[model samples]
Target: MRKKVLDVAEEAFQARGYHASSMGDLMATAGVTGGALHHHFATKKALALAVIEERVAAAVEETWIAPVRMAPSAREGVRSVFAAVAAELERQGFVRGCPLNNLAHELSLADPDFRIALAGIFSAWRQAIADKISADQRAGRELGTDPQRFAALAVASYSGAMSMAKTAQDASVLRDCLMGLEQGVMSSKAGTRRRSRILHRAL
Candidate 1:
């Protein structure tokens, strides 16, 4: 029952803004009495927190973090993620945008607790990419740019790209934006290698 309520809560919150998704609507959709709902969640805020901490966090892990970590090359993994999402969105014939980002925009400023929980997810996401980039750099695969800075830029670029895609109702916008980012990163990598070769010859 708790899981069922949570599933319903996540969908409701995503489909409707936090304020728009009233408790009454949730109870009706979940087919639970108000007592049963409150027995599990205590309040709507508690329910939202749980959704953010659990559902949203898990989605980010599966959708973004896992892919970035799994690829043989960190930069390739990041680019593939962007390409895959854009392809899926185009196939679906709609643009739902990034789920974590959607809620971040809606609830980040709504409450301090919401902001903190959401920030924690973002931090974990950034850390994953930064760690991957650092490892790749150490391996001499992508010895360009600061890992933390690149991670920050990637997160922000994806968020902005998703927003643009949603507004334009075109998934290609995402591909375009992300591809530009990749070009910049690859240019830096090439430049760094060139400088390294020059210094090696001088030594």
Candidate 2:
């Protein structure tokens, strides 16, 4: 029953902003009595916090963190995630935007708890990507770039692309953004390698 409420609530929050999803709407959608809803979550804010900590956090972990952490390289992981997400948006025939990102934009300024919860998830996501980049840098694949900044760029690119895609109702925007980002990363890496070789020979 708690799970049911959380599941439906997450869907509602994602589709509609937090402020717009009234308690009555959630109760009706979950088919739970007001008393029962309060029994699990004392307030709508509590429910939203639960969704952020449980559902939203898990979604980010599964969708971004795990793949980035386990992939062969940072660039490959990011590229694959972009490709997979673009494909998924196409298959779903709709771009509602990323759930975490959507909620963050709407609720980050609404409450301290909401801001903290959303920031934690974003931090973990960025850290996962940054860790991957740092690993690659150790192996000489990524050079002359701060791992954290690069990870932030990747996150920003995807988030902005999703927002644009949602507005355009086109998945191609995501693919197009990914292409440009990948080219930039590759170009910078190659330039770094050239400078390194030159310095090594001069020494």
Best by lDDT: 2
Q: What is the C-alpha lDDT of each candidate?
A: 0.89, 0.92
- Model 2: how far residue 116 lies from native, Å: 1.0
The worst-scoring run of ten residues by lDDT in candidate 2 lies at: 141-150
Lowest summed-lDDT stretch of 10 residues in model 1? 137-146
TM-score of each: 0.92, 0.93
lDDT of 1 by residue, 1-203 (tens): 89999999898777677889999999999999999999999999999999999999999899889999998877887898889889998999988778788889999998999999999999999999999998898888666678898899888888899989988899998888888898887788788889999999999
TM-score of 1: 0.92
Error of 1 at 190 (Å): 4.6
Residues 112-203, candidate 2, lDDT per residue (tens digit)?
98999999999999999999999998998776777998899899999999999988999999899999898888788788889999999999
Residue 3 local lDDT, model 1? 96
Query: Which regions of candidate 1 deviate over 4 angstroms?
Result: 190-203
The positional error of residue 28 in candidate 2, measured at the CA in angstroms, is 0.8
Spell out the clash pairs found in candidate 2. none
